[model samples]
Target chain A: MKLRRIEGDLWEIPREGRMRVPGRVYSVGPPAPDDPALQQVANVAHLPGILRFSLAMPDIHWGYGFPIGGVAAMDAEHGAVSPGGVGYDINCGVRVLTTALEAEDVRPRLHAVTAQLYRDIPTGVGAKSAIPRLSDDALDEVLAGGARWAVRRGFAAASDDAERCEEGGRLSGADPSAVSARARTRGADQLGTLGSGNHFLEVDRIAEVYDPVVAEAFGLVPGRVAIQIHTGSRGLGYQVCDEFVAEIAARRGEFGEDYATLPDPQLAAAPIASALGQRYLGAMQAAANFAWANRQVMTGLAVRALLHALAISERELGARVLYDVCHNVAKLEEHAVDGVVRRVLVHRKGATRCFGPGDPRVPAPYRAAGQPVLIPGDMGRYSYVLAGTARAMADTFGSSCHGAGRLMSRGEALRRGRGRSIARELAARGIEVIARGKKTLAEEMSEAYKDVAQVVAVMDGAGISRLVARLEPMGVIKG
Target chain B: MRLSLPQPYEDLGHTADVGVRTRGATAEEALARLVLAFAALAAGGAAVAAEREERVAVEGGPGLAGSAVALLRELLYRLATEALVPAACEVLRVDAAGTEAVVAFGRRDPVLHAEGADLKAVTWHAARLEREGAGWVAQAVFDI
Candidate 1:
C-alpha cells in the first residue's frame, strides 16, 4: 500500500515501523490492486538484517505466509530465513532436459512415452511412489548431498550434461538433524513422485529462437526435443511448513506486533533472532536438498522411460540435464549494499535467482554465461529460457519474474470449461495430454494463465534477463 | 443438479463436488434449495429425509459475486473436515456482507455415503455463480 513508482517496471514500498528496509516490486504495469504482493513486500521488511529491499516479481499472487512471486534478502549473520518465504514445496522448481533426438524421432512413440512416464513417475495427491525407500542414513546423505548423491549411486552420469545445473544439483548447509521425524515419515516413500497441484512433466520441442548465442549456450536448437520436469519435495516440505507455521504463531508475542502481525493468519512470522527461526532455516535447507535429489531420481526414471519407449540405449537418446534451478527457495548469498559486499539470506518464493554471468555463485562452466533461468508457460503457449545479467544484480540483487502468472483461478477455469471437451480441444491443437485426474486437467486448461512470452519480453526489454529460446509442448503428463 | 460422494485422498475420508442448476422465482430460494440438494447427496436421501432446523450465515463481498459457488466450497471444507452439514441458506444478504448467511443442516457425519470422489483442495480455476436465462446457475472444480 506504500507503493510509489520508481521507474518503468519498478515500484518501491518504503519500509515502515520495525521494517529494516523498503520493499521493491517488478511489474510491467501497475500491479493488480487486490494482489497481496505489496503486503508480502511489507512483511519481508520485518526480518532481521534485511538488505536493500523486499522484492516481488510481476507474476505475484496471494499465497500463504508470502506472496507467490515474493523475494527478500536477509543478512546471513544477523538476518532470519523463514521457511514461509520458500514455501511448502521446498526446492519445488523446474528442470529443462534437452535431448539430441528430434521431435520427429519421438512423434510415433508419443503415447507409449507418456504412458511410460506416467507409470514410471508416481503422481496425484497423497500418491505414494514405488521408488525404493532410503535408509535413515541414506536419506540424510541425500538431503545433504542432493544430485551428487544420485550421481554417486549411478543414477546420473557426470558428463557435459552434469555441470549445467545449479550447484550441479546440490546445496550447502543442509543439516538433516534439523528436520523432524514427522517430515521424514511423509517423505519416506515419495522420492520420485510428482505431487499434484501445478506439477507436470512435459515433452516439448525448441519451437523458436529469440537469441542465437544464448540458445546455443543452453544446448537448445529449433526442432530439438526436450523434457521439462516441474515438482518439489512433496510431503516432507509440507510437514516442514505446517510445523513451522504453528511454532512461529505460538511464539509470535516474542517478536513484537510489527514482526508478527497476521493480517492473514497464515502469514504469521517471527523475528530472525528467535530459536524457531534458526531451526526452520536448517530444516528448510535440508528439505531443499531432498527436493533436488527427488528431481534427479525422477530425471533418471524419465531417461529409463524414454530408452524403453524408443527402444534405444541411453547414448542414442542423448537425454541429458541441461539445467535444474530451484524457483522457490531461500539461500545465503553476498550482494552489495551501498556498494559494499554483504551476506544476506535471499528468499525467492515463486521466483528464480538470476545471477549474472561471472557471479561467483554460478556454476564454473556457466560462470561466463550467467545462471540459466527457465520460465514455463501453460500448456497452450510458449515457455521461455533466459540468462541472468549484471543489470539485474545492480538493480534487483539479481532477480526476475518466474512464469505466466495465473489470470483465472482453477475454479474459474473449470466453470468456463463445463460442457466443452478441454482434452479434445488440446488434442485438436496437436498436444497430446494424459493425467490421472479430470479435475486437474480441467483446472490447467490453457486459458487459465497469461501469455508467458509477453511476460518474458518485458523482463528482456527491462534488461533483468536475456531471452535464450522458446519451448513448445509436444506431450504433457499432469498430476 | 448432481450430488454424490467421491473417493477419499489424504485428509478427509470422502469428499463431494456438487454441480447445481435450477430455475425459479426467488434467487434465495434457489440457493437454499441448492444447499439442500448438496445436503441430501452428502447425507444420502435416507439419512437426510428426517429434517432438523439450523441457522447459519454465508459471507463475501465485491470479490464474491459468484460467492454462491465459493459458499459450497466453504461448506464442503467444513463438512468434510469439521463434520458440519448445511440445511438451508437464508440468502437474505447476497454479496453485500463480507460473508454470507444460511440456515444449514447441522449434524455430525450426516451418514456419509460409501462411494465418493477424493476431492482435494478447492481450486481457484473455473469457479462461477451466474445468472442464466430463467434463473441462477453455478459450477466449481474441486481438486481430486
Candidate 2:
C-alpha cells in the first residue's frame, strides 16, 4: 500500500481504486511498509459515505475488518454502519476510581486485597457472576437502564458515578426488544463478570503526576490508590455482533452489486437509513448499555472487596469514580465535515473518544478540564491518564489510542514464557497478581504488549491528547 | 462405526486471534472436523469427550461458503450461550436447494475440563470453504 507522510506523526493514504475517502494514520513515525494494519485502514476507506478519512491511532494493529485502533465517521444519513467496525466486545471500556488510602498503606496487604478481589469477583473462561441470575424482566431493565440500573439496584454508590461516564453511563435508543433471547440468556449470568483475555481489575498508585492541575481535577494525587476496571458486555455483545454479521452477510445481495466488490466479507454493511441498520443500531446500543451496567456492578464489588480486605470502613475507603470511557463503540456525534458540522456515526474500534474542553457533551464537573482519557497498560508497567484536546476534535474525530497494542500473538507469548515464572517476576517488582487461569498470566505478560509509554508519547506529541498523570499497578486480578 | 483417530485439522497462525484449517473427503466431513478443531481451541487440549448429543439446524446461505459460516455460527452460539462444545459432529442431512443442514453434535463434558481462552465469535475474515482437487478444505478464524 502507498502512503505519504502528511506531517510529523501523521500519514495519509491517497484515495485510490474504490476508496470513498483518504486514509489517515497517526503514529510517532510511519508504520512499517508491510504492516497488515495499513491494509485494513485502506479497506475501511472503501466504505460507502465515509467522511474525511478512515483514521488510525498510534497503537494500530491488524484486526478483522477495521484496524484495531481505527476511527471512522460515516454520514448517518447516507453512510453505512458495519458490525466489524464496532468490534465483538461492544463497549469494551475502562473505569477508574480514586480511593482515600495511600499506596504505602496498601503495600503491606497487597496480596490479601488481590486475593479478596479474586474471591469476590468472577474471572476466567465462562465464570459465573457474583450477582444472582437475572430474570427476563430484570435483564430487560439492565439492558434499558445501563449503569443507572446498577445505581437503582444499589450496585453503584451514587448517580454521580453514572454522570462521569461517557454518554452518562447509558446510551439512548437502547431497545431491549431488539436483543434476542439467546443474547439475553448468554448475558443473564455473566453480568459483573470479567471474561478472559486482557480483561482485568487492578489496584494502581498515582506514581507520577504529569500535569498537577489536570491530575488534581481528576482526583489524582501522588501516592493515592486507584482502582481500574477493564471489561465489556461479555457474551451478550458477542452474540449481538455475531447475529448481525451473519444477517448482513446473508443479505449482502440486497445492498446491490457494489457490496459484492468489497475486499472482505466481514466488512458487510447496510446504509444507516435501512431497516436492518436501524435494528442493528438498537441492538448495539442495548449491548453497550449492558457493558456500562457490568462495569458499574464490578465497581461496587471491587469497593466491597477492598473494604473487606483492608478491614476499613466506608468512610475510610472514600472510593469515588473518576471516569469511565468506552473504547469500542459507534456513537452518533456531530463533527465538522469539510467545515460544515453534521451528525455522523463515529466507529471506534480499540480507540477512545477524547472530546476536548468546552464541549458541552462533557460532564459538568469535567467541562473545565476536558474528558479524562483512561489508558491502561500491562500489569508490570505504568498506565496513563490523559486530558482530551482541541487538536483531536479538529483532526482525528476526537479519538485516541486505547491501550498498549499486542506486540506478540498469544501462541508466541506462551512459547516464549515456557519455563519462566511471570508471576514471580511481577512479584519482584512489588506487584501482586491473582489469576484463575494458568496460561492467562503468560499470555498477558507485559512483554506481550508494546511499550505503552511510546504509544502515549505519540498521541501527546500529535496533540490529540495531553498527559495528566501516570499510574503504576500495585495489585492486579485477571481472568 | 467408530470415530477415527488423528483428526484432519491444523492450527493456523493469526495476528490476534486463532485459526484452523481442516481437510476431509467431502464438504460435510471438512465442516465436521472444523467443529472439532473449534472445540480443541476452546478447551485448550484434546481431553474433551463425546458425553452428550444435541441436534442443530441452520439456514445456510447461497453457496458452500455461506453454509459453512451459518453452520459454524450455530455451533458458536451453542458454545457461548450453553457452554456446549462439540466433541464430534455428524452432518445428517444437507438440503442443497434450500442451503440448510441438520447435524448431530456430541457435546463436550463441561464439568471435568481445563478451559482455555473464551472464543467470543467466529469471523468471516479470511474464511474459506472450497473444493481442492479430489478432496475438500475449510478454514476459519475465531475471535478469542
| DockQ per model, Cα | 0.05, 0.63
Candidate 1 residue runs with Cα over 4 Å from true position: A14-20, A157-162, A262-264, A271-274, B1-144
lDDT score at residue A331, model 1, on the 0-100 scale: 80
Q: Each model: TM-score of chain B?
A: 0.59, 0.81
| Clash counts for the predictions, in order | 38, 0
lDDT of 1 at A294: 84
Instruction: Point to the candidate with the largest TM-score.
Output: 2
Per-residue CA lDDT of candidate 1, range A284-314, in tens? 8888888888888888888888888889888
lDDT of 1 at A307: 87
**Tens-digit lDDT track for model 2 on A1-479?**
89899888899988999988899998756678798888999999988879999999988888888989999999999888999999999999999999999999999998889999899889878777679999999999998999989988777645578998999999898989999988988899999898888999999999999998888889999999999999999999999998998889778789876665678888888888899999999999999999999999999899889989999998899998999999999999999877999999999999999999999999888788889999998989989999999889999889999998887878888888899889999999899988876688988999988899999999999899999999999999888
Q: What are the lDDT figures for the candidates, one per model?
A: 0.69, 0.86
lDDT for residue A244 in candidate 1, whole number 0-100: 73
